[model samples]
Target: MTPHEALDDLTRRGLLRSLKPLPDNRGRLVVAGETWLNFCSNDYLDLGHDPALVAASVRAVEDLGCSAAGSRLVSGHLDLHAEFEAKAAAFLGFEAALLFGSGFLANLGAVPALAGEKATIFCDRLNHASLIDGIRMSGMKWHRYRHNDPAHLDELLTKHPAEAGETRLVITDSIFSMDGDAAPLAAVAEAARRHGALLLVDESHAIGVMGPSSKGLCAAFGLKPDAITCGMGKAFGGYGGFVATSATLAALIVNRARSFIYSTGLPPACVGAGIAALDRFAETRGALGDEAMALAKRMHGLLAEAGFEMPPFASPILPVMVGDNHLAQEFAARLAARRILCSAIRPPTVPPGTARLRLTVTRAHTGADLIAARDAFAAVARELGLLP
Candidate 1:
C-alpha cells in the first residue's frame, strides 16, 4: 500500500496519532489559549517543574554545557553520571548500575545483552513495547505467558524447559502502564526462582511511588529480581534510564550492549535533575508518591460511585475503559471540552478492543482537581449514555 493509503486506513480505524504541543503550567496545561486540568502526565510526583530540579539542571548546564559530547565509553561518562549511577545503585539495593540514554535504549540494549540467542525468554503478554522490542532483538526462543498470571508463567517454563546450559530469563513490568494494574510480584518471583530463571522487572511506573522509601514494588514486596530497570522520565521527572544489577552484570552490559556503546551519554542537565530528584526522595521518604496515591484512590472512588467501571486502585494511573476506538476518542474529547485533559489510549499500544482514557493523578493535582474531574467525567458519561 502507498503511504497515503496507510494513513487513510489508520484514520478510518481510529488509530491515527498526532502530536499537540500543549504548554505546561505547573500541573495545568494550556490548549488553544485555555488552561486545562492535565490528567495525562506520568509525572507522579510532579517534580518535572520543581524549583530545585530546575536550579540543579541550570547549574549542570553552566558547568558542563548542554551535551555529554560522546558515548559513555568514549569520554561521555562524566563525573555526574558516575555519581548518579552509584546513588541509584545504592538506593535500589543493587551492587552497581549502568546508565542509558533513555528507557527505550536501556531495554533495547540490556535485554539482548543479558539474554542472547542462547537463552529462552518468558515475558508477560502485556509488557510495554520496549520490552517486546528488546526480546525480539535478542533473537532468543521465547514464550508469552498470560498477563500477571504466575501459574501460566510456571506452566510455560515447565513446558519449554531450557536446553542444557541454555539460559532461562523471565521478564515483567511491576506495574502495567496502560491498564493501571500491578504484577503479582511475590508470586512471579517465586515462580522464577522455582524454575531457576533470571528475572528482570521493569519498574518504570512503580519507582518513587509504590514501595517503602520509594525503592520500587520489588522492594515493597521484598522480592529481589536479578535486575530492575527504570526510566527517569516518570517519577524522576527527567530523561534517562538505568539498570540496577550486580557489578558482574553491569560489566557485561557495558561490554555487550551495543545501544549503550553506540548512543551518546545522557546529558548533564538530566543527570543533575535526576540527582536532585533522588535527593528530594531521600528527604521526603516518598511522601509525594503517597500523596499522589491517595489522590488517585479518591478519584477512583468518585468514578466508581458514579457507576463507571474501574480497575482497583494500584498506582497513580487510572484506565477508564471505553472498548470502542471511536468512543474512547469521543470520551477524551468531551473531557477536554470540560477543561480536563486526559488522553485516549488505543491499540496497538494496547490490545485491540481495549481502548481507554488513561487518566493519571500526580502530586501537582489537588483534591479539588480530582473532584472537578470526577464531576466532568460523570457529566460526559451521562451525555454519552455510558452510565447505567
Candidate 2:
C-alpha cells in the first residue's frame, strides 16, 4: 500500500493515537493545561522538570555551548561527555561506560555488536522491543526463554552443544516495562555462569528507582552483568542512554556497534545535564527515591482492595489489569476526562486480553494526587460497570 493509504488504514483501525501538545511539566501529564494528574509517563522520580535539572542544562549550554557536532568516532566526543561517562561508570560500579543518543540506541548498538553468527542470544520473552529488535537485527540465533524463568533458560542452555565453539549471551530487562515485573536475575546469572555464558541486562526501568544508591537492580541485588544498558531519560530525569561495561567490551562496541558509530553524539548540553543528574542521583540516596515506590505500594494496595487485578511487581511501575481491549480503552478515556491521565496499553505493546493501565508513580505526586487518582479510577470503574 502507498504511504498515504497506510496512514489512512491505521486511523480507520483505531491504531493511530494522536498526540495532544503540552504546555509544561506540572506533573506526570502536563502542567498549566486543561488536563491534569498524569500517570502515563516513565518519570519515576519526577525529576524530569526539576528546577535543578533545568538549571544544570542551562549552565551546561553556557559552559559548553550546544552541540557535539558529530559522532564520537569523529569530533563529537566532548569533555562533558567524558565526564558523564566516567561518573556514571563509577556510580554504577563498572569499569567503563559508553554513552548513546538514547536507550533504544544503546540496546540496538550493544546487542548486535555483542552477538554474532557464532553467538546465540538468549533473551527473555518479555524484553523490550529494542532488545528483541536488536537481537533479530543481529543475525544471531535468537532464543526466547519464558519471562523470569531461569529454569527455561537453563533448559535452553543445556540443550545446546558446547562443542560448537559458540558463545551464549543471556539478555533480559532488569525490570519488565509493561508488566512491572522483575527478572530472576540472580537465578539467570547463576545459570549463565554455570553454562559459561555472558549475561546482559537492560535496566531501563530499575536503574534510578531501585538499589541503595539507585545504581540499578544489579547494584541493588549485587548481580553485575557482562553489560548493563540504562536510560537517563526516565528516572535519571535527563536525556541519553549509556552502556556500562569493561574496557575491552567498550572498545569492541565502539569499533563495531553501527547504532553508536552512525548516530551523532548527544548534544553537549544533554551530556552535561546527564552528568548533573548522575551527581544528584548519587547524592540523593535511594531513601529519597523511595517516595515513588511508597506511592506505588499504596496504589497497589488500594487497587487490590478495590478488586483491580494488578500485575505482581516490586517496582514503581504499577499495572491495573483490565481483561478486554475496548473496555480498557474506554476506561482510560473516561479517566482522562476526569483529569486523571492514565494510558490504556493494549496488544502488540502488551499481550491480547491483558490490556492494562500502566501507572507510573513519581516523587512529584502528593497524597492528595494519589487520593484523587484513586477516586477517579473508582468513579470511572463504577461508571463503566467494571466495579460492582
- Candidate 1, residues 216-259: lDDT per residue as tens digits? 89999998899888999999988899999999889989998888
Best candidate, TM-score: 1
Deviation of model 2 at 37, angstroms: 0.7
All candidates: CA RMSD (Å): 1.0, 1.9
**Which ranges in model 1 have alpha carbons more than 4 Å from their true place?**
none
Give the clashing residue pairs of candidate 2, or none: 26-31
Structural RMSD, model 1: 1.0
* Residue 353, candidate 1: C-alpha displacement in angstroms: 0.4
